[model samples]
Target: MTAASTGDLLTTPDDLFWQEHSESITESDEELLRIVGSADLPALLAALAAATADTSFLSGDLRPPLTPVDTVGHPHGGMTPLQQERGRKVAFAALKRLRDEGITRARMLSEAETDTILEYLGNGHTEWAGMLRHELDLAPDKNGAPDWRFEDVAAGRDFTALIVGSGVAGLAAAHRFRQAGVPFAIIEATDRLGGTWQKNRYPGVRLDTPTFGYTYSFAQRTDWPQQFAEGHEIREYLETVAERSGVASLIEYGSALISAEWDGDAGAWSVTTETAAGTRQVRQFNAVITATGQLDIPNIPDFPGQASFTGTAVHSQEWDERTDWQGKRVAVIGTGASAYQIVPAICAGVERMVVFQRSAPWMLPAPAYHKPMTEVFSWLSRKVPHYAQWYRLWVTVLGIPGRFHTVRAEKDWPGAPLSVSPRNQQVRDELTRILGEQFSGHPELLKHAVPDYPPGAKRMLRDNGVWAKALTSKNVTLETSPIREITPTGIVTADGTHHEVDVIVYATGFRPSEYLEGIEIKGKEGIEIHDAWDGDARAYNGVTVPGFPNFFMVYGPNVGGVVAGSLHFMLERAGEYALKAIREVLERGIKAVDVRPEALDRFVEWVDTENRQMAWGQPYVRTWYQNSRGRVSQIWPFTNVEYWEATESLDPEDYDFLA
Candidate 1:
């Protein structure tokens, strides 16, 4: 069955087109189409008559009709099913027409008008509105960049910055520089921006985090249809941000950075870019920000006899969208985040899906996994001031903070390996209850789903419940045995059991250890970045390195959030820091500002020590968080606030400044 077009799904074409193709379509045309599509002529006339009569249907306790109500039956209070359906349709059409013409309308205000409507909607909850105002930068002193002065910097010199990659992080950095009145150019390896979002376009690929929280703080999106957005929506959002922020023109599509070297005498880094036209051009820039994220490269595990016998094999990241799996017996490796989402989505379509589970992940209940937002809820969200903002804040504090708290070890606890303390146990117990409730009739299924490791030892998966239900289905099978080799037909286990399969999807995550490994970066004294890192990636605040002067990395090593906080928040912080660093160079007449080796070392030491106290660093669980040497090097070990404070200001003493 073909999926329904996005146009048919939404009630208002104005909102739908804006959500889907805002950059492409005209707003007035979209609104006109929406009004015409929703209502009939009779309903339109009724709405006009109602408006003229000053009749109001708007109410705080408004709810959508249960089935359908007939206006003809209003005199007698009873009507046929067909009459009820037709009258309800006409009434809805009338409402749409009246709304479109702006005649006796009840609509919500935009982000700019949120403050004025706060008193009317807040109902004496001034603190909530105050917080919303502060967050949205409607209030004074809440400007995101307090340190960087655009006028002073723009007047000094025409300095240039070389930004690597055109993903969210890179796009954000470029925007920050543009806002700061700095001349910069972005070199992207691919022909498109959006980084991972642009690359990973698998059938069911979507963000685990909510869209509102995932977006940049400076650009708050008020119209997310779903709580958690899909990959296409995210990519569109990034593209919109780039175009609107004026960063789209600055990006050189199909331009890959081959190498970057610092010149002590010139006091600039020479960057080489290989364009799609097969020509190489070298440009000099005063600063560089490596915004290449961690998960760009795919990590495919080496299984024995894999090369000899294969029907069709592909990684989750490198998903072949065109590949047909209609009646094919498919084998899925790994039960991680990607696998969790992918399995359930494709289970019904495939003939047989055999999932190879290495370890079970901690699954938290998510009721909104499959539920779509009701029209009433959407209307309420738009009408209510500070409601959506407060909901987002609640999610940030309660949902995000508890994730960090679960990782910390406590002295007294019943379950040593499963939980660290009483609070941790409460989390585990809640998860257990959710699992039990989901698999009420089948205790055996619940047993298989329960994780043995402590919560947050690995990435906690949002529960779909469909995964458990799918496993219990007749066509699905879950295998825990180790695979010895892949035969011509299928996989062979260590126990000499052969499970035949037509296709295989390796959901094994990215090689995060090889951060910026492919890029050839040479600093002063002819030191390559790869050699400097020595396979153990470390950075001062996960932005700047000691050897690579004037070179910064956004979403770099140990800078990722451990809690449920958005990755965009980290990217924003890094961008803020980059702006500060660039401003200092232009103002102070400094040629290069390399991080002090001592400071970088101390920061790495602190990251390591802090991670040791978390569950990801525990000896039992094997995750992508560690390097080959078994050191925790991927995730940040502190709260989101700590990172915000650390990168909010730039201290000159942290770096070695040279004339």
Candidate 2:
């Protein structure tokens, strides 16, 4: 029918259905115009059916096959499903005839149609924009540039940089040096390119952050198969980033940085590395950047006779994929984030799973935790301009602001050990309510599932009922008793009770406090990094150290965020500062630049003060975030914006420069 005559059809639901279902329909369709003006019955029905189909698809239901329905031979009436399926030949002919005969010319414009069209175009434009960005190797600016400039340096004949750990951070540092035309090479303890991403290949191991936010600010990936990329994908992405950025050539994968000493006479750093070939090589460099992340070493708790466990035991980071757990009674130690994800994943195959919980994680609801993108939504994201961008912005807001509410302390809260304040208690109450709703019939289960600690005291876990379901399952048992020892057959509790298991998975987290333990870093005056802090790692802005002149650290101690912010945000800021400092060293021909003692002290004091105000600093909370001195050593006690602003400009007054 002609667009004008389609007014009657547009008023009916059928017209609405046709307009909504037509993927090729442009923004200028007149029947769409009429439907836009008034509610169309057909479109409503079509929309409902489409939504139903999407739900079914998401739930893994089989889709019905398209079958031809009979139709009357009256212009638009005779358009049977079979005819419409004829590769658009019949539909185009019918439309042409209708327009030619002037049977339909009614045009009704509506705000809804305009919105829908704009959404479509917006998504299309975004896809194009992403493609262009990927091709150009451009990452979207997360924060504005820093307000620092490199000071002029005395001309020097030689300039060099020593990078420790050939991981993402290390490689990124090397890449930055390359771009700045600085000579540098990476030294990694492992004979591999991917650091944590390379080492951790357990099943279902993946990034919790979105792929876009997780990647470097200079590299953008448009074709992430999943919104949250798996470990393999992340590793591969890092590898690609290295290769495409030409930094891979500069990496010496098997060479491990053993120790680095600053030579005051030479005005350079003397670095020691152990090669895979069993040879030790010492090189000198003008600067060093420690890119070793915090989550490398697995922190297996010491239970008496843990070595005596007869069953196969492995840490989550060192998961033994070769060993099968099917029908075996498995014991999982710790209920942290990795444990939370791995427990539910493997509980189905295990005959009986015993989870030993030292502490419970404060669980947050993740509605789309296991849900996949609907085909319609995916299509709209790809085909419509700016549609996906706006949707992403909405998601970012939820994560940035709303998520931070859980981290703040609530004073005078009734629930001791669980919530610090009333507002914190409300969050706990909400989460407990969600758990209650999930386990509607099992009140007893709620007691064991809910955590007593404040929400942000520990890492908040994302839940999808998988954990709750696994817990309530008949094959699962939760243990809260203090473990006395690991017997030949299984675990022995403090009360002389034994729980037998065929396999043990240590979900105990990492040794974040032990920053670069094995690697000996000797700074100026024969000072080692280990001895400098005496196991208490601290730095000015978590980048520059006092005695370790011209040295920088990315993702260093106290730079991590417990709140739901991006780590990349911290990495970029640190990198920016490092780059500016390096430029200053080059420009002024400075032999060394160490953060002033006062600056370092002031920064540490500020970090401690801010951390005390947060839940991580609470005495009752026992997390890897704290060091041996019971200090919050792993987390940054500031907002993402604050870090960005603070690192935006490198103050020359903060450092002592020597020429």
Highest-TM-score candidate: 1
The digit string of per-residue lDDT tens for model 1 on 1-659 reads 11111112222211111222111112254453444343222222222222322223211122112111110012112224454445455445444443444332222223333443332223223444533332432233343543455567557565788889889899878877777777788888888889999988766787776566677655556567776788888899888888877788888898888889998898889988887788899889988888889987888778888987658888887788887777899999989888888888888899998999878777766657665554543442343222344344433432233356566776544577777666567777878887788778877667877888777778877676777877777788888888999988899888888999998999888888788866789998999998888878888888998878889989888987755466776787787787788777777777878889998889899989889888777666677899887888889887665676678668778987888
For model 2, residues 1-659, the per-residue Cα lDDT tens digits are: 43333422232210101122222234334553333233211112212212221111111111112121111012211224443234133223333333344332222223333223222222222222221221111112123232332222334357777777767777667666665666677777787787888888666677655554566545544345676677888888888877877877777878877888788888888888887888998888888888988899999988888888888999999997797899999999998878887888889899999999887777766555555544444443332222233333323222232245556555545676777776666777788788888877877767777877777788877676788888888999888888889998899888888999999999898998898878887787788788889768998888988888888998888888766545765776677678778877776666878889899899999989878777778777877789998999999876555675567667988988888
TM-score of each: 0.78, 0.76
TM-score for candidate 2, residues paired by index:
0.76
Which candidate should be chosen as best, given lDDT against the real structure?
1
Q: Identify the runs in model 2 with alpha carbons over 4 angstroms from their true place.
A: 1-156, 374-377, 384-402, 410-416
Q: After superposition, how far is residue 63 of candidate 1 from its true place, in Å?
A: 28
Alpha-carbon shift of residue 98 in model 2 (angstroms): 27
Off by over 4 Å in 1: 1-134, 145-151, 154-158, 275-279, 384-394, 397-400, 411-414, 439-445
